[model samples]
Target: MGRQRKIQRMAAYRRRRAARVFRGLKRRLGWALLGIFLIFQILAQLFYPSYLTLPLARYNREPYGLKHRDDMVMMEQSKFVSTRLELTGSYGKEQVDLIKLGGRLDESANFNNLSYYPKKWRWVPFSILFWRPDVLTLPITFDDKPLLNYTLNYSKKHSKKATDASISIRDGNISIKDGKKGLSVDANKLRLAIKNKYIDTSGIVRLDVPEASIEPSASSADLLHVRQQAEDIISKHIVVSVAGRQEEFIPSKEQLASWLRVVEESGKVKLDVDSQVFGDFIDAMDKLVAKPAGQTIVSVVDDREVLRQEGVTGERVNRLDFEQKMSSILFRPGVYKYISIDLEPIMPEVKTSYSFSHTQAGLQAKLREIGRRYDTRISLQQLNGEGWGASYRGTESIPSASTYKLYIALRLFDEIKSGRLNWQSSVLGTTVDGCFHQMIVVSTNQCAEEWIRQFGRTALNSFLYERGISQATTFTAEGAIRTSSDDLLRTIIGINDGSLAGGYERDKLLDMMGRQIWRQGIPSGTQGWTANKVGFLWDYVHDTGIVHHPKGVYAISIMTKGANYGIIAKITRELEAQMYP
Candidate 1:
């Protein structure tokens, strides 16, 4: 009896071992099969037979969005994938590809003149199933000029022109225009005929023309829905809450209506904001709603930031996403609630601590490289106190043409602020304020020269040197009228930050700088609000400006010899890419 029990246990152990061996063999086989399949895929990519069909399709990557309904993306996908696509079609016998069809449509590009564009082959097996299912956006371009011309000529000679259904809103009132169907060329049918003839390759080619009744994009029901939507928009009121601020911005209903218009797209009536009006409105609201970013100076030594100052984060409205938010709320019927949007946070251009990613040495290298290419001495410095901006040749003083007029204006304003001079004080037979406008705005030299003579060159140089504007500067044409990018940066920063000029004088200076007529240099480069002073003489051309942005205020001074405004523009653009990137 004991032996029988022992034999049963042995049998069970042997059975378990066999099962383990079988499982090991199965895994090995699976891995081997996978390796073979990968090898085949690689080979197929290099060498595959032409004239083969594969079950594959391309789709848009961004068909899904936050603005879309829950089912809209799926519906869009279904609608997109179900579209019957044909690369080459034939009418009776002659093959019609995109180039052929395009050639037929264009008057200048005759069918005989167009060279056939061959297909770029891709031989991946079952790519749509395993890889790139919902991300491949196939690029397609269609020019309908020839088709429009053909239709115009046909309507003039034989057929009636079809009118599209349209909706319009005037003075908060809605109007709908009904569409009428008319005999039109059947483009799809013609394309199909061309495709059919292309596939056969065994018949006499005869191009055939097809005709069908044209249909309008918007239907009668859709027009009614659009009218209802338009009515809803005019009556709706939106409250924009910015970062939970106390003031909730609410534009008047009339103002909102004036900025809106109704249109049809993709066979459906939709609401679209007038981009021009929106741009103007957003510009006005930028400072009101969007908080500007803050900055901090970091001390860098031995390729690492040792000490850093305090920092603050700022935020601005994401224009595209904000538009989507408005559409999501305003377009839907009975959606009268305020849009809850989380404004995108903007980080300071100067980081809290400088790391290896952006060390002082790296920046100097880039500056030197760009300067070498332009074959001109370049100096760019930040206005942040204590630490200098860009350290490479920042204090190399060159001739200051009209840029020094900024400094002259500053000195004159300083005198007025101290009661030694007044706005009505005379310079070159004009009031000080009036002369300042002419000096800064139009680059006129009379007021600046007269003011310098009145103040005396020694006193002017003493003021600049004492104020820590420049160590050695001459604004008086005594020697060469020299100033550095560092001085310009400090002067602008002082005015804006209330270090140099008092409130009233500061405001006056900044406004004039922004309105400074010659903005072709630094102003043209940076994508922000710029207030710059430009100087141009025989060989010297310089631009120094404070470019204000929601990220952080940037002070730049580009002084060049034998380089035009074009090079200055290019240099500023390159500098922004370095600082902000």
Candidate 2:
């Protein structure tokens, strides 16, 4: 028992000793860790910022907020947890970060400075965590006007004023000083180039600055009057013999002005009337006394022209005798001149022929054939000339994908023309022009939906029907916006033929359609240019266009089910061959 007690005591003492050693080891480890931590904090504070930044400048490192165009870009400014130490503050930290920037600008831009640049001193914070946000604005702006304004300002600053051609009159002689063309920053081109160059998602204030010739106020052509030619010595009076009767007449300024003209001939100014002009004067005098002859309307039967009725020939003042006598009187500076006159019989003509050769039978046959062969619904029309166009199930309504945007375009056009809306008039947040272009060229759905909502699809449909722009076409389709090939042709013909939109507005739509990016359909098939709007959804594919063929302009609308653009192109080629042939 004593031995057991002694063994227990020895074990207890050893246990106590082991516990103390372990405690000492743990204490030493804690101190060592504390020292390492202090060193790291010192180093971190030395290089990185100690305080937090404001709302904007946290780029690239542990970004807490959104980093997008117009939106503030967030990032940790490569700051240490404790930058209060003397060793803190990277000399060119922002520049270093910029050099180490991993992001890129827009694809169109090539900003070399973005990739690498000399380091600059970082902003000394007025207060810790109060550094200005490294907020580089996006080159792409939602308003798209800031850069535009900048470009305008830049152009104004750089544009040189043009010197107009100087005119001087001295000693009865006029001379001209050639105008000088001044240098001007082409603001439009500069805007485009800068936009393209800085598109790299790079910061907004990039200085990659990049049209036109500035014509002087007057060019050489404008100074044509500057060349001096001696004025004609006005004669006071002249004598003329009319039918063997002699008479004396005085000259007047009006008569002289009418008879004489100044001309630059062979490097000399000759203030005189030429032979052709004299003859013209005689003809004009004759017209004052002559009566136009009655013309017989002719009829063309079987390619043969026959006079339906006879008409009397009219008499005109015979200019031959008078022209011979008074030919040189005006240019010779004689005042008033009398000449012999006579009458003669003259014949007039009226032209008549049939023009439009509408391919009603042939186009109908071809459209029918195409529809049967393709095993899909089709619609086609020839919208150029006088005859009613041919079609295959063209009146039947079908789903319209992007093609439905045509109605929006047409309606928008009407609104703008009627002063209901203007080019800058807002539709959904964008300008009328902007939405129109986006709806037509880009074939975007959001803008179209917005337009329909704003303009009321029902009202638009009513307008289409009332204006005869479309008979059966509708804006709100049951399953999809419904349209007929004929209806589509009607709008296209309206644009191309001036039956719908007229003047500049018509040209704008046509131009946009011609340049629209989607061209895999009829445009690809036809040799000539095709201004078209295309649509596709699910198994439906369609193209509507006005094609300018060498023979004539014609409109074509092709809609299909379970088909692709290749098929549409094939159909276009077939129709082209048929119609043109």
Candidate 3:
């Protein structure tokens, strides 16, 4: 019994100790839970306190209250407005009305209308506590195609087409039209203005459609001045006459009107006379008043024929002087009643001609006398009927110097006549005719060399041989071709008789020879028209040509060596005196 009582006491003490330990653990766990809840509340207040207005936080504290006040005011005062478009100038006086260009006011806040909201939320921390007003825009909507089509139609209907200033002649009178300004409206600018007024939702809207000015090319006053000047010129009448002519030419008023022309030059308008028509009229008048030149006649005096009468001067109208006078007369209103023209006199160089048949012996003696003074061998020939009539050592060939250029010119013309070449065909740096002119008139060696290079030397020699000029040869000695006096005389005779070339070719060659720049040889001694060629090199000198004399036309060729040009000229003068005296 004693052992059982000891065990019961130990069990009771163990139960009491267990109960005490459980109470201490429960107290510590309750304090830890309270600390965790306090930390969550502080975090919520610092970050997202507005979330505290939910049911959980509301249940913990008093019910969350929101301060409400009807304090928001409408930001845009005047909403309902109208738009007007105006057009000016030649586009016509018109105004277009655009209805409902602005937004309508809504008393109640709606999705489509502009409204204001409070600046802050209900329970947000560190934010405004009361509601503040802010504007929200709601744009008005409308179709733009109708307004665009209406604007374009209005602009087209009232627009004036621009006209350029002009001047014209009708029934011998001048007329002019002045230009006017025009206007055009811009449809794109009007469309943009209408869209802007609706987007802004403003109270009042007024738009002036953009326009541009269209100007004409010419003005009215300028054309009127040109017309007045033209009329004044056509109304005036003048008489023109040539001296010693029975016919009188008075320009008709209609002809005068036809001469007037309106032209624009150098950015300016002008009234001018037609120069070609005036020149034609002057040419016709000149032909009617021209007179043929007189020739000297030989008469027998004391059983000897001698030159008796000197040639009379002929009359011709001066066209250039008459044209100048007419220009002034036409411009003046009452300066002169009529203009009379006087013909100028033309004098002949040779007044008389003598019989060469009777003087042929005397000419031969004179030639021999003049030639004896020079030590060089001299060859001379005078062409007669179909052949040489008189010659002194004329068969001897010598250096021809530049005289070979004449052959080159002949060959060039031959090619032209054969259709292988033309006068205007370019050779080297110049035309064929230009080369011919330089070779004969100016005696340019470069031109001659170029032509000979183009026209082979062998061909030239063949041409000479076929033409029956046997004594002359192609470039043979010292860069100089060889020719005899008789051969040159034959060539001249051939040219004059039209056997060497046609009339046109022969005339062109003769014309170039006549206008030769170096006239110190044969032409210096002649009194009439002389077409000649001269050649010179070192001590060799030669001259050959056809002289148109009062007695008759004849060919002469003189070649000399070791003689100067002065001696050659003296010899030619003596020969001419003997042949004509």
Candidate 4:
């Protein structure tokens, strides 16, 4: 029994001890759990503040399935941080830090999270302990689709395309286009803007995207310089004028504009004029301003006197020199006061003149002098009616000799004109015209006799009488004829002036006379066309015909008795000299 009581006492002591230990342990465990709950609550209030939130009844309604409530709630709560925001763009992204957006970092959250508390609540202790509190207000809201679309549209509207530099010429003008700067959307800036919209929570949701600017290859100043150069060229003018003349050719402004041109040289614009156009202008001026040299005349025979006028020369515009001067003045920049081109003198190659002096009295004196020297009875006359008349026994009748053939030729042509004889009619197996040519040109006696026999002496005498020559009788007195200088000179004048029969007949007779085989007397000293017939009967020599001179045609007849043929030739030469010289 004593042993049982001792064991029971020990058991009682053990139970009391056990009970006390249990009580101590239970109190310690309760304190430990409360401490742990407080710790978890602090952590939740700081890092995981959203974990304390309860869904709103409206949000929990069926078909109101709100997705990402925590993220949306965080975005909405962050809006209370600031009222303004600053946006920046870089590398195609939009960037906005909390500080730049007028917000602060959550220090309680170890700066790993942005603070969305309002300005008044910033000093409130443990303000993060509440989620969706009434004091918290969202100052800004962001819609991703609207924000993205807005950025894209803004980029599209404001974007610029780069332009290439160019240079061109049009209508004698120069045009230049400088390279342009391009603009594009900054994608980095847009991305930054989106990020800030969710994280910064600035009251202003407006996004500003920076544009990238691309510069041009060429500058505007370079293009302007080219345009100014063209303007200067068109405004300038060039004047062309003669040295001493009042006439001047000034190109109009419009014409100058047409003539002006622009060219590119070494990558630079240069002002120039059309060479072909300028050359043509110079040529036209040359034609108008040039003067040709002229010949000088003094007298017909004196070349030395003609040489005296050699100092007189002409002038012309220098085309090449003028072009050079124009180019010098026109291409450069300045006003040209005057451009003078002097005329150049020219020398003549040959000298010539025409002048003479001789009187009819001198011819008469020479004739009388020759008459006295030769002791010949010379009868002479000039039937031009402008000088001395018939002189020195001109009325004295003389044997016509072969000169009677002249009267016969006159009658034959008259018959031909009267149609009594045809020029081609065969007369004794010879053409009448042929026989006439032989009779006149060769002075054939047979041809003359044939014409006389055919036309008859009565017809010849009648023709002479009608011509106011009563002394001429053909084939009478044993086939001999007689005439005076007056009658022969009258007949020659009639033949020369084309009044004997007709112009054709007269020219025919004159042509035959010109080709006379006997050309010693009148043709010897004459310088031009002459027609004459000479008669010689032993000592009797007679020469008479019309002599063509520069002054006029004149009929001269000289019947000489016992005169040398040389004396007659001398007399004829003196007469021609007086008329022509």
Candidate 5:
């Protein structure tokens, strides 16, 4: 058994050796075949480049067809490809083929004007690398007139090579035998420059016609008539021409056409007719401006529909109507002044609305009676939402006067509520020559200054801004005290309605305002409820306040420019009496 085992081991070893040798021979044969394939590929590219391709598309270094015609031929294939396109042309059996293959031809080519190129051709490249094709452009003309000129910047490629680049356009001419020409462009003055880029060319084509002939024709009389008609049409226009060195005016097309016609007829010319003819036209227009255009209402209202009639057109409004309807609250009829009254708060629950009766004729009779007594013009108004007196001669932009102090007081109260300032905190008072009196007792200007200083001008202005009052248009900066009876009413109502932020209690502010001492202008017999303050100045007696009675708290203010104290007082009283009762 031991001898048999030794012989089997030797046999197995011999078989393993033979198997290793066979495996080695098979691997060597595979490697030799691969090397031979690579060598053949390199030789093919070096000897016949047309058969080669980029590595990405090549399947073992084989040629790949091009994807797009516009794609340039690969440099390796360029030498084997043709690059030019061919064109052929025929005119009445006369034919020509043109080869197109240059940078200049490509730059100026446009397919739209192929009619100009009475030639055509098919491009075919023999060499594999000649894959890119070029285009051909031909010059175009109309009746021997060169209509356009195009340029190709490929001058670098061909120093003196010319690209046929041009355009032609024509409109049938109207022939007039034995007729003088009206205008003609001068060929010598025609300028044309061919730039490489469209941006390099001038956008406007200027035609210079220095001379034109005009002669009477059989229809010349009719033409003259038409020209005269056109001139008349032009003359009717109000030519607003600016006659100065500065370019101040712009003329309309019709105006410019008129001037151009004149320049054509007469040799004198002006580049800008507006600057030349303005003075004459302005002089004529000024005369028409002097008289009012009937009457125009410049005032604007929130609801424009109020000024319009249901069917009939409303007549234009004038200053007189406006003053009577609008400014009546500010002053007496046909005047500018200030009117104010002391309006003390009545009991909130008082019954002031009595039925309209002839008993003393309500508030109207009271106003006439007071007007007779005071000897002053008085006009009462229902500003908030109540009625008292007759609608007066002025509208309601009344001087605010001391009543404006109420606004300051309201602001102070607001500051206290907001924790911005303490009620006990004191500010230095400013003593004006003649304005407000002390803080609460005497209506002194010093007190007004002190309140204004504490609040700060900026804060005051900001407050007014919040209220939508134009900063440029204000009554007083010091203490920012300015009030209109109407506005005061609106403001108080806003406060009551919580429109104004951090508003003061109505009773508290009204009580403080009534404490104001300048109450000499209060109109008697004009009773309703009144909660406001009055102010006085040299030659000015003003009172703006809110009248709160049982009917409703109506705000009323009266102002007069030129009137005796008694006269002004009477007018305000009458206005109030008429409005309230």
Candidate 6:
């Protein structure tokens, strides 16, 4: 009980001491408040009761405490701001990047360098009308030395849209020369030109650094010189390429020039560019003005005159103005238009001459090898016109194939020449499967069979004998027909020489044979222009014709067994090419 009483007495004594300590603290706080009020009153008296008269430096590092500045705030001195900026631009699906630096300038050193900062070397909370949160503070260094009161601003662009940007300076405010303007940069342009010494406001570039940031002194100049050297080294070392447009690594001269021009022009100075890049710029311009690659053509001519017009416009008299002409006269049908005929010339460039006899031998060999190459058989013969022929066994007498039609055509001509028939007396067209059309158009089996019965087999046999063709030549079976190249060439000679018939019958017969539409066997642009008859079966082929070249007309007969139509055409076409070319 005694111990409890003592503990209570001690606890009461501690409570009284705590109360006294609180009273002392209250008295000190009142005195401190009075001192602060007295100091403000003294400051007001010293400045003549006006806040604007206070030195700007006195407000340094102090918050405004919700106070506002008047509209007539004096500009004792301006501050200089420096920056390093970057830009980029896009072309098609490509992007370009560029970099630029600010220039240096001397400023007025006597100006006040003081400002209210939220924290040590941090951005101050200064807003005019509305809040802009993207603003941030930055430290700018020129020639490895930091500058004061310099704020950097950036403008970014992409896909033709521009975004607003601002920057803060870490060092509060410092004195600078008057009439200095800060640079605004667009950060997203690929190419740049800084040729102008002065800034260009209306031009399209990404980055712009003001001239005041760069200094032309010993250390500062050395710093800039090093940067230029580094840039040159980078340009030489770097290789750029755009896919689909170029396979090799190459830089664009125009792109680099654009960048340099912007700066040089801003400063009223000139910039030097690499010669290779200059060449590339010139080449690009040349290509822009050039025509594209495609087909071109002239007109078709016959007898040294424009006979048939195709793929051409304007008057027929304009034929002489063109250097060359093209026609669908060849079997390969299409527009056949081109700039240079060398690509489609019937005769390609040759280094040496070839013999006519050698050409004939090659043609015969090609015909024999046709089936192996093109799955077709073909034959070609060069007759002496004196009735002599060099023949390979399978190519000489491959039956008439369809060549017998030439014989029937000749017979009609013979009758007309004898005054036994008229040129336009229409004969009844016999109807049968494949025969009527074949006789008139293609000369198939049905037509030949029926025609033989009407003409009488004996009379046709006698007709052959009189033409100087071999007695072995005959129309035997329904479709069996036979003739050697030797006999066929003789027939062509007789027709051309006027020995086949006389008068109107001769004219009608040649016209009928000329219009035969067997265009499959012969290709155009041979050693000479030819009027001929061509015949083909499933595996047999023959061409008997007369060629009228610059020299004279000569008889030719080509026959093949076990050959395809494509092979025959190719061989003869090549033969024509080889002989003429």
Candidate maximizing TM-score: 2
Model 6 C-alpha lDDT per residue in residues 254-297, reported as the tens digit of each score: 24322221113444322233344334543563353322333233
Distance (Å) between predicted and true CA of 95, model 6? 57
Which model, 1 or 5, shows the larger lDDT?
1
> Any runs in candidate 2 off by more than 4 Å, and if so which?
1-359, 383-388, 469-471
**RMSD in order of candidates:** 34.9, 22.8, 42.2, 61.0, 36.5, 44.9
| Two-way lDDT contest, 4 vs 6, winner | 4
Q: How close is candidate 6 to the true structure, as a TM-score?
A: 0.32
- Regions of candidate 1 where Cα sits further than 4 Å from its true position: 1-360, 381-388, 476-479
Q: lDDT, candidate 6, residue 577?
A: 53
Angstrom error at residue 526, model 3: 1.8
What's the true lDDT of residue 212 in model 5? 29
522-566, model 3: which lDDT tens digit per residue?
777777678988876434678888887665567777788756567
RMSD (Cα, Å) of candidate 2? 22.8
List residue ranges in candidate 4 displaced over 4 A: 1-366, 372-386, 472-474
Error of 3 at 500 (Å): 1.1
Would you estimate the TM-scores of all the predictions? 0.38, 0.39, 0.37, 0.36, 0.30, 0.32
Candidate 6 local accuracy as lDDT?
0.41
Span of 10 residues, lowest total lDDT, candidate 6: 71-80
Worst 10 residues of 1 by lDDT: 104-113
Query: Which candidate gets the maximum lDDT versus the true structure?
Result: 1
User: Global lDDT for candidate 2?
Assistant: 0.58
The per-residue C-alpha lDDT of model 6 at residue 548 equals 60
